[model samples]
Target: MLCRNCLRATRAAASRPAIPLLRAGISSVTRSATYTTSTQASVRHTLQTRLPALPTFRTYSTSSSESAAPPPEKPDYLNEAESTIWDRLVAEFEPTELVVQDISGGCGSMYGIEICSPKFAGKRMLAQQRMVNTCLGDLMTNWHGAQLKTRAP
Candidate 1:
């Protein structure tokens, strides 16, 4: 008598159902059998073998109380041009405190500024100076010059 397995194999050979052979060491069978074999290469290409999902990033927003109010606007005595340049520098540096002294009268339109910013952390003195210079590109063009003193927070 013919074997049942042999009969099944004969039928399968006559009308073979499409099957996919994945790269060695990968899944033996496609996730869905109904998908055509042409998709197998793409499937294999796209499928990521089981791996741990990356940790999601979490962001926390600060309440007004959590952060201090912005610094009071500079006094009226401060030159408008000087104040504008100072405010831009302070905002760029996010300094603990910035002091801009206009020595322009003595030094021919030159100002001395001291900046303290957490952003300056780990940078060399030259790099810190360059950072301030880069931020003040527009202001620098208008003013005759500046003296930068930067400190890391």
Candidate 2:
């Protein structure tokens, strides 16, 4: 079954003759009128006559000439303990990416740490994590537990 729009297009094409070229060709002697749907014509008419008549828009693009966004600054929301841990890790690793969160209801007893650093390039996963833990040093003694993740950048 033809959709509402397809039905309309088929009807429109049937009622109006196709626009002939400037001059009939020799082949026109034996030519027959094949069926055509005016869906493209209807879409073009809609865009030309209706959409641009309104003030909002006519076209859009997925590209831009602008540069990429700047890097994120250190978070302002961290508490004292979280800040301390962030500083210690930053100094030791010079990481490309780092995140430290207190997952223990804001009491700062348990933390989740993720770090990516060039210093971890030749290390295994266990060794990378060990480096982070060793950098934390005496501070880890105060924590009940930690969830640590490390990656080579």
Candidate 3:
């Protein structure tokens, strides 16, 4: 330990500044100092040289056998006769708001209706629905089921 060269090396190490120790799992970006452009470029080059190239992908061509017809258009939920139910209710009730949905999965057997009208202001829920049923007439018999929700304007 008394050797001149060893003594010089120890003095040199003691004179050098201390580096802050990085904690485990800490990100370098959150450090106080920012990297220079040269440092960033060197890092980019190193990463590019180290990583393997991705496999090239090929484009596919559709053959005549693989080409099929486009899908058929979806069928209408409410046909002309089914749509008239809304019109009849509108004509009779003069509702401020009306919405009718065919919930029969395109069979047009069941309908859900929401009607808001001044006419329903003094009427009970059953009476309001009965009026709608009466307006539907023979069409009501044709329909398998209906859900009626009424509101006063």
Best of the candidates, TM-score: 2
The deviation in Å at residue 46 for candidate 3 is 97
Root-mean-square deviation of Cα positions for candidate 1 versus the true structure, in angstroms = 14.7
**TM-scores for candidates 1 onward, in order:** 0.49, 0.53, 0.47
lDDT of 1 by residue, 3-32 (tens): 576345345644656454454445665334
**Each model's total of backbone clashes:** 0, 0, 0
Report lDDT (CA) for all predictions. 0.69, 0.73, 0.67
Between candidates 1 and 3, which one is better according to TM-score? 1
Cα lDDT of model 3 by residue, 1-153, tens digit: 135763553455456653342333323422113434454355446556756788999999898456633322223565776568777776687776777888888787888988887778889988988888888868879789998898886
Error of 3 at 22 (Å): 74
How close to the true structure is residue 143 of candidate 2, measured as C-alpha lDDT? Answer: 91
Q: How accurate is candidate 1 locally (lDDT)?
A: 0.69
Give lDDT: candidate 1, residue 74. 66
Which clashing pairs does model 1 show?
none
How many angstroms is residue 65 displaced in model 1 relative to the true structure, after the best TM-score fit? Answer: 8.2
